[model samples]
Target: MTMGFNESQSAFAAALLDPGLPLPQGITTARGVTDPLRFAVYRNNVYVGLTTALGQRFPVTKRLVGSEFFAGMARTYAADHKPATPLIIHYGDDFPDFIAAFPPAASLAYLPDVARIEVAWTRAYHAADRLPLDVAKIAAVPPERIAEMSLVPHPSAGLVRSDFPAGTIWSAHQGEAVAPVTEWRAEAVLVVRPAMHVEIRFLPPGDAAFAACLLEGTTLGTAAQKAFAAAPDFDFGSALIGLVGLGAFSAFEAFEGKLP
Candidate 1:
């Protein structure tokens, strides 16, 4: 019934994350040092390594705030949120919300959204790969039945909505900015990795709604109608073509039946 730890795994893990606490009961150094200070080396190494890993995962967040500030903030965050999984690449998914609440970063209200965009990018990059949908097959479907078809979104497709123009902020970091924008605007972002690269695009209002529906398994006709209801000027043709260009879908099949 026992597993990896000589003592309790919980006790060992707690001491690793909490440097102030005494070393776990069964641990010992070669010199037989009894003081908690004996465990300081392991504590420092674990904390430093995890903080560095988080900084790598949230490069934009680090850039958004200065490195020193980010490091300090990262320490505060890592204290409470221990790594739940062995994979560090996907760690810090909640750092955005942590930033939103961190008092020093509160003035920069958009920091959380920017972090979310970064998370989306990392997730898309690691998502499973699949060949792009065949546009010709979709084109051959009868016009009337096309509405009843449902799209199978690629594994890497994602959507992010923010009250701030996070896409523009992210772009500014990529050296694509000519000048800083003064006015604030709401934006919706599409995150996808069609091939080798992960892309972030500012999604049109209707497209986000329509794509949301498709991703949720709604019929294409119902999705488009709902999108049009949200934005009367929604353009189905352009959206479809653009998504196909991005290779956002893997297949298009009838919502409830096989194609003839």
Candidate 2:
């Protein structure tokens, strides 16, 4: 009897995973060589391709774990979770979860958050393009109505809050300016791509709250109130200026059907 396609495919998959297994019947060997040796090359290539793709996605995580350890983790992760899509860029969505449950990485509680930040960075890099708000337009808003104004956050804007100092840790590894510190602290981060570049910045509690409110479609006055509530010394003017500097604000629209 002829083998069904599903059975044949299952055998092929098993053979790829286990080099000891022989290729399915009716599969021809190349150059009259043994099927096992030919299949071994294919299996090795599969591992190498997947490992390379994962490393490219999580370079920071790979660097943190070291080459050998990263390769091992990638192998296990790939075995457990095959890529659902053919796009390599979107291959590692489950990596953070995998790392969180990985036994060897249990000692490093912050590794998962680091993976999340890396994923966010990649997503921001591929987000749709948009022009940042013009500072002059924001400045032209009347002082009286400034509080009633609402600003749109860019499409790529995202906030990440973590108990660990993931933002600081990620920043330290980015080859940017660093400060001497021996202790870890809780952190909140804002990620956005205003023009074409993805930028990540550590945010203070109040600023993070304010940005969250704005991203949630709250009015400027309401968000400022929340920010002040979070941090009594929160500076509205400074926050506004900082957003402008970061290109966080896409455009300004008034609360009452008016345009800034």
Candidate 3:
């Protein structure tokens, strides 16, 4: 059957990741004959390239699972989740979700969150550059009006709240020798690239709740209230200053009336 150029291109692309699919019609070597062996080699190379890309994107995840196991799992993921765009960097946006649902990775409950952290790191690295909210401007606001203001998170600011020590695990993997994670507990991580470098910070006490509320456009007072509810010892002052120091906000909005 005759196929249009676009149709052939689509078929060829699909078959690259899916080895079960037959070679696209009209595909042949320079010798003018279809060679199944050559096509198999090409298919294998495509899977290898994509698996390598996933490995690079999720190095800690790869290290957590041995190279052999990761390669097998990555190949399976690439086969089902083909690239939506031509840009390789954008290929694995859904990988964290994939790892979460993948049966082999079910035993490692925290693996998904770790992948999410890696995903955030890559996104922050590529995010558009913007000037962070100036600390001085925040300090200048009248104390009475502070509660009604909403701080705008930077474009690269992302939160990863996990029930396990995902941030600690991720941080431990950054060094040459993996450090043991003695404390096993929930962790709320802030991933942001305010300037040249992407920074990862573990939020303390009620800071996560406060940051989450602020990111959702809630007023500072409301957010502080929520944080206090989450942590009895929540200090609104320290939390505000710390987040500003990390450059988590790009701008802020002030309301004339009292904010709930």
TM-score: which candidate is best?
3
Tens digits of per-residue lDDT for model 1, 199-245: 88787888878888887878888999988987899999778777767
lDDT of 3 by residue, 114-186 (tens): 9999999999999889999888888888898898899888999999999999999999999789999999999
Off by over 4 Å in 1: 1-7, 176-178, 257-260
Root-mean-square deviation of every model: 2.8, 4.1, 2.8
Each candidate's clash count:
0, 0, 0
In model 3, where do residues sit more than 4 Å from their true spots?
Answer: 254-260
| lDDT to native, each model | 0.83, 0.83, 0.91
> Rank by lDDT, descending?
3, 1, 2
TM-score of 2: 0.76
Best by lDDT: 3
> In candidate 2, residue 105 scores what lDDT?
96
